[model samples]
Target: MFTSLYTASAGAIAQQQGLDVTANNAANVSTQGFRPDRASFSDLVHTGVRAGEDAPKTGSGEKLAGTETLYVPAGGLRQTGRKLDYALTDGRQFFAVRTADGIRYTRSGSFAASAATNGRFYLTDAQGGLVLDRQGRTIEVTDEHPARAPGAFTFRNLDGLRKTGDNYFAPTALSGAAATAPDAGLRQGYLEDSGVDLADVMADLIQQERAFQLNTRMVQMSDEVAQTVDNLR
Candidate 1:
């Protein structure tokens, strides 16, 4: 009976998390360069159940391991006709940028330029991260050479990159090192839209809600069973 209770509790938690992730995806449907997240689950430890002289079998339980970035292909592109706007038709690459802590990466190509105290024009992202090149140096867009393109990088392990806010990602040891993306095919005067699909997100959300209700029913039934036993005593 206790095992059943634990299983039901775990199921409820897992479904709740799935619903939360779905909600986040819906919220970011219009966010540029956004990737949807999916919940990953694993089975928890089980207990053996014996039936009169029969072989023992285990009951089941579950756990939410973690969330994974779907990292699906790039979405449709919209033409902005702006010099700083760039669109990467390929989803397998990232744009490197310099931050206060270190270099971060993103797929968002929206950029702007600002003049530093030294009177040099530096290209930066919308959030003000200085864009970098394959050599990892701040790209300087001088008046004579103002037409600059961003350097792109590709990861060995996509799962090892952690998403930071503002469409940035930090690579971990597990991700190895980021290398220059091959034939990035970056297009100026365009921007890549977010990869979220509203219809799919809504479908997943509805399924998770139903699963949550079922688990809740199980937990309630388990509690009732326990109360009945106490009453009998």
Candidate 2:
């Protein structure tokens, strides 16, 4: 009976974690370049003496395993007529505007040149910071002439891109060095679409909900059984 209780408790904990992950994914469904997280579970250790078992001892209960971030790419390109809108064709990520916090990275290419505050055209992200060029230098557009357009941008290894939230990415040591110059041609009027699959997320949400409910019931049932066993004594 006690083992059953432990098992149910583990189930409840795991289910709760799953619910949280699902909720976050649902909330970010519309977010560009958002990657959904998934929950992982493991069985609990058992404390019992085994009879003639050469292997490790026996265990019967489940455990709430730690969750891992799912980095599966999502969303596609959404063509926007804006000149600065860019999307990576091969999982390359663009550097976000620099902030006091640190340089961040993101796959989101929805960029716009904001008005100059001090004789400088500030290229910023949604949060407004100086965007970085291939030289790891903040791109400052001062020329008012549209003819002097920044042509292309490129990265060394896009797979090492790290998510900094709000559709932002940052380069890691694993990301390798930035390219000497912008090699990838800039597509002036294109925006990256979010890769999230709404149908898949909805299905996962439903599955999580049902699993949580079932786990709750199991815990309750285990409690009742434990109480009944104690009452007989």
Candidate 3:
């Protein structure tokens, strides 16, 4: 009876996490270049089942294994007709930017010209991150100094990159090194939309909520059974 309660509680926790992930995705539906996160689960240990024995298996429960950001492009590109707006033509490439936490990669290209103390203007993103050029240097945007195009970088393992909030991603050892994607052309007057589907996220949220309720009910049932046995004693 205690085992059943533990299993139900574990399942409820997993479903709650799933709900959180789905809600986050829904919240970022309108955010530019926002990638959606997915939750994965793994089953726990099983009892009454040997490695080679054909006995019926009783599983403990499941757990949230991890969450992965889906890199697939969503909502397609939108033509803003603004020169500062840009979008990558392909999926394996990201724009490089210099942030306060060092260099990071992003898919958002909404940029503007920010003036420095030296009266020099440089291309910067919405968060004031300086957009880097192909040479990894800040691109100056002035009449005398023509604005250099932003750099496009590709990782050895795109799936290995870790998201660092604000739609920025950082390199991990598993991601290998960043390489210049010379062929990753940009649409100068376009912006990439967020990688979230509202309808799909809503559906997932509903499913997770239902699963959570069922698990909670199981937990309640287990407690009632224990209480009844105690009363009988």
Candidate 4:
């Protein structure tokens, strides 16, 4: 009886996390270069009789392992006709930028020229992070070279990257070192739309809610069974 309670509680927690991921995806439906997250789950320990006895095996519960970014192309590219707006043809590629917390990577290409200081303008992202070029240097759009493009970078293991908000990603040891992608095609006058699909998000939201409710009911029933045993004693 106690094992059932534990299993139900764990299931409820996992479903709650699933709902959160769905909600976040729905909220970012219009965010440019946004990638939707999917929750991953793993079953806990299991117990069974040895030597294939008549007893059946039972699992303790399941837990949310983590969330994975889809990293797939969104609703295609939209023509913004803006010189600074850019889109990468390869969805796995990213633009390298220098942020306050060192170098970071992002898929967003909506950029602007920072205010001129010392007679020079630098390409910056929405959050004013300096954009880097293929040589890992801040890209300077000089009058002589007005069509400068940002650098494209990729990792060996994309699964090792973690989202750092603002559509940026930070690499983990598993991701290996970032490398240049010289052949990464860039569109100068377009932006990639968010990868979230409202219909799919809503469907997941509903399914998780139902699963959560079912787990909650199981917990309630377990408690009632315990109370009945006490009354009998």
What would the TM-scores of all predictions be?
0.90, 0.77, 0.94, 0.91
Which prediction has more favorable TM-score, 3 or 4? Answer: 3
Model 1, which residues run further than 4 Å from truth? Answer: 51-58, 141-146
Q: Write the per-residue lDDT of candidate 4 for residues 1-233, one digit (tens) a residue.
A: 89889999999999999899999999999988888999988998888835577778889888999998898664479999988888887888899989999899998889988865777888889999999888888877755243468888999999999888888999899998899996557888899888898899989999999999999999999999999999999
Model 4 ranges with Cα > 4 A deviation: 49-54, 142-147
lDDT of model number 4? 0.87
Q: Local distance difference test, per candidate? A: 0.83, 0.63, 0.87, 0.87
Q: Can you write out model 2's per-residue Cα lDDT over 145-211, one digit (the tens) per residue? A: 2223332333565556565677665667876655534546344566656655778778877887787
Worst 10 residues of 4 by lDDT: 139-148
lDDT of 1 by residue, 1-233 (tens): 77778889989998888888889999989988888888878888755576555667665667788998977688779999878777788787889999886889998888888778898888888878899876777777765243457887889999999988888899999887899985556888889898998999989988989989999899999999999999999
Worst 10 residues of 1 by lDDT: 139-148
Model 3 regions more than 4 Å off: 49-52, 143-146
Which scores better on TM-score, 2 or 3? 3
lDDT, model 3? 0.87
